[model samples]
Target: MDWKGRRQSGNIEDRRGVSPRGGNPFGRGGMRLPSGGMRVSGMSFKTIVFLGVIFLVLKLIGIDPLQILGADPGGVASEQSSPSSPRITEARKDEMTQFVATVLAETEDVWNGIMKSQGLEYPEPTLVLFSGAVRSACGNASAATGPFYCPGDQKLYIDLSFYDELAQRFHASGDFAQAYVLAHEVGHHVQNLIGVLPKFNQMRSSMSQSEVNKMSIRVELQADCFAGIWGHFTAQKGLLESGDLEEALNAAQQIGDDTLQRRTQGYVVPESFNHGTSAQRKEWFARGFDSGRLAACDTFNNPV
Candidate 1:
């Protein structure tokens, strides 16, 4: 991908070493247990209620709930302190981190230029690198939740291990595929900045679950198009190598909800398809890449 020796974004927040375990009173820990000291593996409802009562009592007394729970409000607290040494188990893994930062920087550059041309400002979103589990302003998520962009914090969270899964499990290999993943999440951040998500959320309140899911498909497909818009810029700059576009297109096809569902459950459910079919994903991405104009990427205005 020719990412080496490129500028890396300084917006990276490395939380790889922080254990998802240990009770964090401040609600900032990577691995957050439920209220009242509950654990993921096992936690009784009775205990949850008991802890809830205690928490309520503490709140009623005007006490800092986290202070009573023995958690440091400042940062992740652990007896085996030191924010885990920067450990990259493999050379490839280290390179992947560099690649992520580089791609983020490139996105910033591309979006900045595009926004500036339109008389708008582009505020860069922070990229958070974590492992296992992490907490976000939106919610806590395990690595299994995949990469996501949190509108609440204007940050993108990723567990690089997902790249391995993308290659091995989803059969979506190549550096460009990995780049597309980050770009897609960044597209969500862009949507958040422009108020698409807020409008969707407002509209969703009046819709049924199935109806909301239908709208969600438009949202996701738009992000795919946005990713392709980034690809268009990169290609125009001659940064894309041969077969790079194919890698991204293949990735879009591979991760479609229909494809995943068929592979897992041996069937497909249209009503449950929130991210569109493989054809839709590939089409929208191609649409954006072909026409770099943001107006062409409006899935909501046009049919998906």
Candidate 2:
């Protein structure tokens, strides 16, 4: 968790202020066309921000609502905010950006070594940092959709503000917990490279929602285990602090499908569970953290 002065990943795409619809966040008055002409996009600036809010209300959240008014939405904030979170200032966000880059660098180092050991070259994935909504080969996703890995483009997309929600809303704080989230997404990238995700995506069309959900649980659990594998090596590097392991476990528990369901709707629907139960998540992560071997992460072959 002592991440300062570490080598940050260079594969970051920062589009935090730009609208996914491809608007210039710095431009005022009217939105321009992709051609960069004086012609407007048939909407006023107020209308753009308004529709953006509508997008969020329909979804409940993304990273943060970019303050897109007379002020440049893309520009760094000159003011500072509180630890109340998600109210993150430009300075605070810069710090978080550095943290993310550092974590990605660590993952890159770990995966590069692991893949090399397996006689395969690891192609490092890009990390896309955006605000509100962003487009990927996977499709357009609001930050509300959360961080994701787009196998089509071999990139990781995130709105760093999601970490604030993790800390303040989910009560899952600590730098390691944040790292766990990104590492899990990167795990999907690993899965994609190893042919797991391609086969799953290809086969899901023939699957019923229930069957897909079941397979998805296995896939997600494996990713959690992979994150633990990363943690195992990171700990060996002596970068993890006291309680870091517990922090990740707590994060896994808090975000489990069962826990989220009970918290949101006051009931658990086993049929709807896709990411596994709290116990299952914690168990798989521990399995990988304890073993740190690819053989231990065979979620599909064994019962998860």
Candidate 3:
């Protein structure tokens, strides 16, 4: 991967230093006790009930008192920063952050051209960099949750430490593999733009758990295919080195639900597989790599 000195994305939100624990639990809501009881201090029982009534009334009218107070709900991580807040750590002395920005820029280039060819405008999604935990419009997540795309905010949340985990823990190491991860998440953003995710979210609630899992396999495999589509364009630019494609394929293989299940549990449950098996993932990615057309990456109708 000849990524050095390449164009970098400016759509990065760095929240590495912000503590997951914001402040004042009761400021938003009453304290949550260990025994599952609410504890409100400096207020009587009647006052607490009165406040609760007020909260309900505000909730019914779609107003949030906390927002009016200019504070995040539940004292969670916030986008707002202050001089008193924790200082954000600099981005890795120009290593991980630079690589991520370069890759994101490349994805933007590929997708922009493809979308324009289809007579559609591509809306670029922001990528967020966090350390331990971060908050999105969807919810809060820790680094252990891995990388994810939040349709609610049109942002991709990632903790760069996951790259090390990918290499050491998953045994799939390469710059291209890292790029594949980002591209896969960006593929989800593309799905969101094309209404695929909206349809899935709308229909999944009425589906059985097993049915949802099966559908999820299709969704994830399609993202893998989309990643490969990005790879195909990247290769045309003569950016891929020898074994670069294999690195991505191995990454797709290593993170497959079947492979992970076998690794962690020593057995595989086909019914519980949501992200497809190793062979399925690699196959879908290879399909997109071979044929860069959008029609080649459909995992919903055809076999995955």
Candidate 4:
């Protein structure tokens, strides 16, 4: 994955330091409002007492002290505030962000071309970079959920820290492995755009748990296949090195639900598997890599 000097996506929203609701009203710390309207959180004790006397004097005159406070009297003027979050000085040293962005850019190029050929418009999805927790149209999610695609928002949420976990915990390390993660999430966006996700959701109610899990496996495998399709273009574009494909294959093998379950619980349960087994993942990825056509990546029609 030679991602250097690649174009970064402009769709990235840098909401890193900002709160979801815009800005915290409470100055740096908890705010205490004076009877009239002044915020007294950071004020001196004497100032607070002076304001309290003025509030009492006003109240004695049959006037509501809250009227002096800002807009809504019932509403708290300040919620709470904290120190600004640490800046991403170290983000410069981390190659993963650049790699992921490049991968996303590549997907944009490939999908845009593919959609154009089919007489459809391709809308590029935003990729959100966050640490720890993030809020999405899907819901609040911790990094433990790994990378996910929110169809409602048409964005991809990834915690790059997961790459460290992929390397340290799953022993899957390589630039291509990380690229596969982004590609798979982008694949979900593909599903959303193509109406596969809605169709799958409609079938969930009528299907048994095991059957649904099987469908999920199919969905995941297709994403893996889509990742490989991207890999095909990457290789053709001279963006991939000799061992890149193997790195992605190893990552696919490492994160298979069966492998993860066995590693965690000392047993493998087929009925509980959402993603496919290691062998199935490798096979589907290989199918897409061998043939770049979208038809070859259709896991829904083929029995797994």
Candidate 5:
């Protein structure tokens, strides 16, 4: 992982200090309203009827319901403000921020080159950095949900603190491990760009939950393979150390759905697994790394 003097991406949106009212950004707790507002406990049958009638009339007239309610549509309606959490120092946070930016720039370079070779334009996705919670087109997410890619927005959301948890709880330490997580999310963005996400979404209504979960495992494993493709390019650029590959492979194994479930819940549930097992993830990633070909990542057709 020789990332010194690498170019940093300007696509990072830092929203670490912003807070939401009511509940945490991840939508766990109930939002408390300000004074003079309708309280859930105070609402009676008559009040509910009156509000229902008002909403119906507003809908009939094509009026924006939120505006009719005299609410600040653009402002945070949750808690006012809280003291900032002091997990990482400002200097360390900045360093991690730059590291992510550099990795994103590398992914952009590799994907753009690969896409151009296939006569397709590659649209780079933004990486958003936040703390505590963040609002996304997909919905509100707390740091607890971990890093995720929102296909609707074509952006990656991450909280750097999760890296700490990855190291401490999952024992997946090393800078390369962190890079793999980012690369995996970027892989989802690639799927979105190449139409895989739309096809999967279309099948959701007809597929059972277990079937959909199997599809999700395929999707995740494909991302792992894409991350390995990135690693191949990075290695070609002479950026990899001797043990860097092992670090990444270890990370891939450590975060497998089965491994993670067993660690958290003391049991493994195969049908509920969205991400592939340790061996499948490592194998697909190694396939991509060895072949360095996008076609090698056809997890949908391969047995998992």
Candidate 6:
């Protein structure tokens, strides 16, 4: 994928080094609040780095540092680290940050056109980049939960470090593969916007665990198809190179529930599967890519 020099989304929230609860990440005693003063103790170099990152993030989000440290907002006065604060230039220019913003911009462009063609408007979703853990309207999630789209918040959350695991563990390394992952989450956002997610949630309220899991498979497969729709657009625009499709397919296969279960437990339980099998995922994506129509992505009406 030739994504360089491309438009980048302005909806990215770079919360990379902030703690999950928007507090000190260096554990207890690393930072302390004493009456009206902030105290620092036993801070290592890495801890200081994290503090700098947090300070930068808080300012970016417009949260007063003194208020966060338990001081009265009106009574406190200090030269705190902020966006204008000089220490944050390097962190803001991270390569992964640019890559995510670029991919999100592509999704926004493609989906906006797609939705408009159907006489609908696409409300672009925000993408939140975080490290370790983050909170969303849906819930708090750790990095172990993987990248996800929280419909409740209408946002996408990701830990860029997942790219390292995509290469090292999943063995699916390529720019397109990473794009596919991000697009798949954005696909969920599409589902949310179109009422598919709400209907699914309503249906799941009366469903058994197994039945809910089965419905989840359909949802997951449709997102895969939606991602393929994005790929179809990119390919037509000559942005996708040879082997890019293969990389995406390989990623889909590698992350399939069956593949993951077998790799982890040495066996697979079909009924326990939430996402589709490897073959099913690849097939649905191909269906969308080949047809380039939302009608082809009816994973719920037809057998997936």
- Each candidate's lDDT (Cα)? 0.80, 0.80, 0.80, 0.74, 0.79, 0.80
lDDT of 3 at 245: 95
Error of model 5, residue 5, in angstroms: 1.0
Candidate 3 TM-score, C-alpha based: 0.77
Please state the error at residue 143 of candidate 1 in Å: 0.4
lDDT of each residue in 1-304, candidate 5, tens digit only: 9886999888889888786343333222111100111111246789999999998998899997887567665555412322233333566887899999999999999999999999999989999888777787677866767888877678888878888877777788888888888888888888888988778877777889889788878888898899999999999999988788988898888878778788777999898877788898899889888988999999988786
Model 2, span 34-111: residue lDDT tens = 110111135789999999777687557544434433444434443323343445465798899999999999999999
Candidate number with greatest TM-score:
2
**Steric clash count of candidate 4:** 2
Error of 5 at 13 (Å): 0.6
Model 3 lDDT tens row, 49-144: 999999899989999977976887545455344433344433343588999999999999999999999999999999989876777766666666
RMSD of each: 11.2, 11.2, 13.1, 13.6, 12.7, 12.5
Error in Å for residue 61 of model 3 = 60
TM-score of each: 0.78, 0.80, 0.77, 0.76, 0.78, 0.77
| lDDT at position 230, candidate 2 | 95
- Residue-wise C-alpha lDDT for candidate 6, range 130-198, written one tens digit per residue: 876777766666666678887777888887777777877788899999998899889989999898888
Clash number for each model: 0, 1, 0, 2, 6, 0
lDDT of 1 at 127: 92
TM-score of 4: 0.76
lDDT score of residue 137 within candidate 1: 76
